[model samples]
Target: MRTPLGGNNLTAQQYESYPSADDTWTVSFNNSAGTSGTYEVYAVCLPATQAP
Candidate 1:
C-alpha cells in the first residue's frame, strides 16, 4: 500500500516488495525540494498466503 507521509508538506511515492521468505515490504522517500524537514512512516500487515 502506497500513501503520503504528511498531507501536502511531505509525501511518499510508493511501497515496494523485497525478496524475503515471509511477507515483507519496504518504503522510502526523499526531499525533492532539498529542504530540511521531518516526516512519519506507517505500515501494516494484511492476510496473505505463504508459498510452499
Candidate 2:
C-alpha cells in the first residue's frame, strides 16, 4: 500500500512480507524521495489457516 505523508504530502513506498515459520510478516515505508522517515506502519498476521 502507498500512503501520502502528512506534512510533505508525498506518497510513501512500502514493502511487506518475509518468510517466517510463525506466519509473521514485516513492513517498511519510505518517503517519495526514497528517504526514511518517521512514518508509522502497522501490520497484522493471522494463523495460516485463518488468513484470507
Candidate maximizing TM-score: 1
Candidate 1 structure quality by residue, lDDT tens digits, 1-52: 4334554554334445453446555555655655455555556667789999
List the candidate 1 regions with Cα displacement exceeding 4 Å: 1-24, 49-52
lDDT of 2 at 30: 55
Measured by C-alpha RMSD in angstroms, how accurate is candidate 2?
4.7
Q: Once model 1 is optimally superposed onto the true structure by TM-score, how far is the C-alpha of residue 18 displaced, in angstroms? A: 5.3
Kindly list the per-residue Cα lDDT of model 2 for residues 1-52, writing each as its tens digit: 5454566645565655565555555666556675444555555655557557
Clashes of each: 0, 0
Q: lDDT values of the candidates?
A: 0.52, 0.57
Error of 1 at 40 (Å): 0.6
Candidate 2: segments with Cα more than 4 A from true spot: 1-7, 19-24, 34-37, 50-52
